[model samples]
Target chain A: MQRTIVFDVLNNDNGQVKAILGAKRFIEENPEYKLILVGQEEVIKNTLGKYAEKVEIISSNEIAHKVISPRDALRNQSSMLSAFNVLKEGKADAILSSGDSGSYITLASLKVKRLPNVSRPAFMPVLPTTTDKKMLLLDAGANLEIKAEYLNEWAKIASEFHKIIFKSNKPVVGQLNIGTEDYKGTEIAREANKLLKEQADNYSFKGFVEPSSAINGDVDILVADGYAGNIFLKTLESSFLGFAKLLKQIYMRNLKTKISALMIKKDLKGFKAKFDYRNTGGAYIVGLDKVVVKAHGGSDEVAFYNALNQIKIALDNNVIEKLKEVFEQAKEGEDE
Target chain B: MQRTIVFDVLNNDNGQVKAILGAKRFIEENPEYKLILVGQEEVIKNTLGKYAEKVEIISSNEIAHKVISPRDALRNQSSMLSAFNVLKEGKADAILSSGDSGSYITLASLKVKRLPNVSRPAFMPVLPTTTDKKMLLLDAGANLEIKAEYLNEWAKIASEFHKIIFKSNKPVVGQLNIGTEDYKGTEIAREANKLLKEQADNYSFKGFVEPSSAINGDVDILVADGYAGNIFLKTLESSFLGFAKLLKQIYMRNLKTKISALMIKKDLKGFKAKFDYRNTGGAYIVGLDKVVVKAHGGSDEVAFYNALNQIKIALDNNVIEKLKEVFEQAKEGEDE
Candidate 1:
């Protein structure tokens, strides 16, 4: 059986032609997957050449209109909304976008709707750790003002998502905080801790985890409000990039150092690849009725291809169906 | 012009003997400065040997008693508290402690008291950036719950501190947020942004800065609530250590890489030093009536000595008196 994946090829830094070519390559690699390119038909055909014939085109004149900013994107619907409409109509198994995340999230929530019993949707991204395993950081930047219940829901959603994606039967969920102590953090954190403890039967609750522990692979999933989670993720990213930049400066210091750098260039490249966000595809907009993966806005061809691969994985593994079943069961238990 | 500095040689990982030696060396190098060692008399005398005669000892048997954790340190009065008492009584010009930060902060706030009209005290630490200039990150981990007013006060205090220390006429203050957009974050952030904007006359308001911009030195002072600030600081520290560990593993993979590593070992050490918190001494407990510096609990001899050096600078520069005058003038203006 083939699955249709909608690719939003607008507002990305790589330009529409490059994104369409990336999507065409993805379709060629995976015979079981098909693409619906949502952008200008003439531009897609001209850039993709022979490959454009394979993908279904959803033409939109608004694709080239400047969004001004993320705030502007959020206030008005862009061409990316056309992509989500296809997903909502059951024409696509999953949707991938490299546009404004805030706008995509808002449009997805309004158009596709939320899962049963879920008050808020979250952005769950897999982060590479020092160990062989990867950690899931949730609520990356969806809801700014989060209640205790939202964190509890995120933990549950992430745990199931982890099980489906990573094949872990029982994943440990850690709430992000300033300290690992039970009594640490704000009023919302303490309340969420209690709720998570009570629901330990559903998932393994690992009390509190600081930002360092989250990066060190202390737990399978780390959950937090969008504000703290965003800061934590951005800090880790910036620090990694900062160190890389410093190393480049050192490597280029003199002729002697440049020779030494060349001696270990292969090893350094491998190390840099481990911290690259492009390799991880993009974050999943969890708790949505349909599958939506947000690729980096500045994504290149390689990054866009990985994001398309992620959607293929999600569709193959029945992630959306499994998530819906879990929430439905929980609601049934509450009703009884 | 000489300053009397009290060193709290308790709760540090280097034990009393090693801490005493570090302090002894600091006093010997600076003939104009005097020392007051706060610890058990027997341990101080036994460790000091010949240096014992030159310094004063404020003995406390409770110095050897285990503090257990930061929470335990917060509840009881320890030897570090005895040192704070000395500073409160005007016996020492400044105080430096290498113990549990929460306990030190609690004792300092209780004994030394806060400056008039200051609701909460904060920890302000200098972090090295890619640029030649260093950045001041405040409220590193003091109050868990912060209001817009607290941020307003932090900007005012940090601006004054920056003007005195860095000799800048006006410092630019950046509030840490998820985005630089005007309508990006929570209500707290929105309110604080408005307050910071209104007070642009007193200091240069750089607007909201993401975690990456903060580390890259987009502004002179980065202000955030303790919860978010601690996470940001800890994430940077952990990420730097993680990358260093990864590089070491890569370098030690083969004989060829090992030789390359040895060739760049000196440059690597220098690069690592720029990100070291120990080199910056420790974070200062700002908004207090007196000078109090909190060194890392696991600080070694060199780190402890640098912390003491920080105290000496604080005292010699009349930081306390200047801060008091600033607050007093502000209060007078408010009364009118």
Candidate 2:
């Protein structure tokens, strides 16, 4: 059976050229899956060349810009919306975009159908930790004010994604909080912590964890209300970026420092690879019926290729199909 | 006039020995000021020696351990509580503690009276940026949920402190959000953003800022609701710590890397000094009538000395006194 992904190869911060190149690479490498490319008809067709015959192309020249309201985002007939429409019409198995997250999330929640027993969809991004493992952080921005039930539900979906995506038997789930103590955090956090502990069948619940634990890779899935989670994600990214910038300045200070940098160039590259966003692919909008991944806005050829491959893994393993069955059965059990 | 600070020398994560040494150093350096030390009397007295005669030592063997309830924190006869009682009784002009933040905040809110026109006290910490100038972040786990009015009030208080501490005539104030976009974040956040812009009277208000702007030191005072602010602070601190740890591992990998390390040792030391917590001192419990600072739990002698210095600067410049007058006038205006 052939799988398909609706690729919104436009509205990227660096322009559509890199996204087009990434799509071409993915198509050339993976013959089992195809992409319905949504972008400027001429550029994508001209770029894909031989691979053009292998996939479908939706003519969409309009790029999605940051809008003032949710209504504006929905009303705009952009490539991102076109991709979502394709996915909503069941024309593809998944959707990928490097567009602004605000509109992407708005479209995901509006267009994508929720899985059984799923209250709200969450933005779950695969993150690189200090260790060899990669972790998942959910509700990073999709729903700032979330209920306790929403967290527990997201945790289950995120853990399923983690177990299949990362090849873990049972992912360790943790609620991101100021402290690990039960007495800390808001009422919603405490309630979610209690619920996760009571229902730890899917994953090994690690209780409430601090941001340090998430960075150290102590848990597989770190859940929080969208506001705190987004703050954590952004700060973690900027701090590393800031630190690397300082390190570069230090190495480029003078001839002696530049030579010192040359001595450990290979090792430094390894360290850089560990924290690079490109290798990890993109953020997934979980709890939806189909795989909805949002690539980085500035994603290059390598990053987009990795993102498509990320979708391929989730599709090949039938993680979404498995989740549908699990959720449906749980709903049935509850009704009984 | 001689000034005094109720120093809770017990409850340090490292131990009371370092706190005593730090006190001795501060007292030696400043003949006009004194610390009403609250800790194991024998140990503090022996460590202080001649300096012990200069400062007041209150015998308190009970260390403030982590308690389950707010009632327990206040009811317990620990050194922290004892120190707070002494401060509340007007025996000292300030208070300093390197204890657990949870109980400390609980005590500060309950024991310490708010300044006139102040709704709530906020936890403000001076943070190091990539640049030379330090920035202040407030409500870092002090009040997780807040109104827009609280943010506006905090901005006024934080700016006053920033001006005196950073010696900036007009500090640049920015409210930290997930994004700089106006249409983003919670209602309170958006409202606060508008309020800050409208009332850019005291300081040069720079609307809403992202975590990146804070790290780059684009704003002098980065304000946010306690939940988001805390998440940002924790993530930033841990990421830098994590990066530093990775860098150390790379340099200690082999003899070649070790030699490479020595070549850049001077530059690396400069980078380390910039991010070190000891230099930045401690977090201020702002909006209180008296100057209250919370040092890092694992603070050593140098860190304690810096924290004392931080308090001294606040006291010497009469920042608290000025704020009292300003807030009192505002209250009177509001009454009119």
Candidate 3:
């Protein structure tokens, strides 16, 4: 089950240094995975000292920290592109970047290309389960305009990935919308529901699901377009912050409240940990010819290390190949 | 100012009886507001008992509840229609209903009519503040499709309302959008920003405000279309519940956690109190000729009573008249 994976590190924020250190530490522990850190030569080398000899650093300051547009990746010829090149050269399994998501998708699609029969690449993050491990949510902010057929494909792809990676026997794929009822969404969602139901034998279609359902581990795979999914994820993130801020206000209210804070400090930490995006790692841009993961903007070493771990599993399972097979079969079935 | 106001209370769910009882208590404490409990004669009498005499219970078993559409109010014999008749007759200063919001808006608009120069009615709710106190968030779910001109009017009306209600000298009006940048939102929002800026003398037109900014209490009046506002309100409600649930799970994890929960239980209660929507009166359907409030669907008796309290204030201030005056002044300024 052990697999070797390359880390395409982009020098953007402090997250890059953290990611480098995380990948090195992970490689040191699991000698099966080889580490390739790509960014500013001196910066990557300085941050990654002892493991510096073991890790390979690809240098290119072409790409700046914060990419303004997807066009910038093509025009600027930045570090992100250099790391992407490594994947194109077959030297690395997949590229993981904490840089601009739009740029990541743009570069991966134009350079790495799409799997046969795939229209658009979808970014899916595994949201940590409130009780158990995690659930994968797709189109977090990748595919803007998606068809019913595309969602069906996403459902199939995510189902196979969940079963293979998470080891779920029969992964439940739920189409997300404003409501769970059949006729509760926009024209696209409603149409998608009908189409997905017709091909229920191909995948486990759990009907429609609401935004609240996504957080509760109701389904193994939650599907939606980028807009709704973006709002869903951002809301979760902000809500976590809101609750944290509220807790701080309560504890800092007065001397009595401060004294009481000691008692529930551990409990509060446990509560906050459930919403920690860091533990889950970066979202994989699924339905692509080659694997690409978009790490969180504020990701630390642990999160980056986790992304590297994700890359290894994704590579070993040949997710892209499995997805391609599903796409072909699904398309043939549709035509018939 | 001691004022006598009547409530056309609609008993929709099991909590209706309690809500009525809470209003009765408030009526007794204030003696300023009289209770007009409208519904089935038998149920109202059974619930209120001796206090039923004080409350003028007009018999109408055919009360439109959740199952009934807002259009059902158009039916002559419906209880909701009968309640509006009371307001029309000057029997009630302001009508408060905990029934379906859509039905309330539909009937209230027809019965009360729109304020002069106001093309569409708006509903504004006082969202719970993360700051020192709460602020008004307009069109919370009133008008779905609003023009730039309508938003400009909304700002003026909201500013005047805030001055009378919240007592802000120069009420800060902000158009809600994704970001604060010059060109962050849709065409409607961008134009609203422009219009608001032009009329800065009337409304302290702040720049675009984010969802977090609304909660952060940076502005007095936050205006947006119903669709976005509905999503925003629901997001906040769902998030509060989700976070509370997470905290409960953490505290009940083990004996140690339970012990910690006991220590912070008081502070946690205080923290949650900040978000208790029950304290604030129900949402006001603004721009209507007559004053109307939409109490929370799951609101208890205390919340209902709080809503009834606002009825008298709305009546005394003659919010409808003030809204008309504001609109006239705006038109005059345009003429000049």
Best by lDDT: 2
Model 2 residue A251 CA deviation (Å) reads 0.9
* Shift of residue B61 alpha carbon in model 3, Å: 2.3
Cα deviation of B329 in candidate 1 (Å)? 2.2
Q: What is the lDDT of candidate 3?
A: 0.73
RMSD of 2: 1.2
TM-score of each: 0.95, 0.98, 0.86
Which of candidates 2 and 3 reaches a greater TM-score? 2
Candidate 2: lDDT of A234? 88
Q: Is the docking of candidate 1 incorrect, acceptable, medium or high quality?
A: medium
Worst 10 residues of 2 chain B by lDDT: B61-70
What local lDDT does model 1 show for residue A271?
83
lDDT tens per residue, model 2, B291-321: 9999999999999999999999999999889
Q: In candidate 1, what are the lDDT values of residues B1-336, reduced to their tens digit?
A: 767878888767767766787787787788788888888789888877887888899886565233335556545656787888788888887788877776777777777778877889998888887666788898998887789988988888888778766788888899999888887777888899998898675689988999888888788999999988888888988888888888899999999899999888888888988878778668888998777888887787788788888777677778778777877877898899
Top-DockQ structure, candidate number: 2
User: For this target, which candidate reaches the highest TM-score against the unseen true structure?
Assistant: 2
Candidate 3: true contacts recovered, fraction: 0.25
Per-residue lDDT tens digits for candidate 3, residues B1-336, read: 434344555545654577667766775776555667677667677777777777677776665543244455676466677888888887766777777676777777778867778878888887776776677877766666678877877787777778777766898887777557774556787888898788776668888877676777778888887655655666666677777777788778888768767777877876777778787678988887677887787788878877876766677777777777777886787799
What are the per-model C-alpha RMSD values against the true structure?
Answer: 2.4, 1.2, 3.8
Tens-place lDDT per residue, model 3, A34-62, is: 66777778878887778788777888666
lDDT per residue (tens digit) for residues A81-119 in model 1: 788889888898788888877777777777677888998
Q: Which residue pairs collide, candidate 1?
A: none
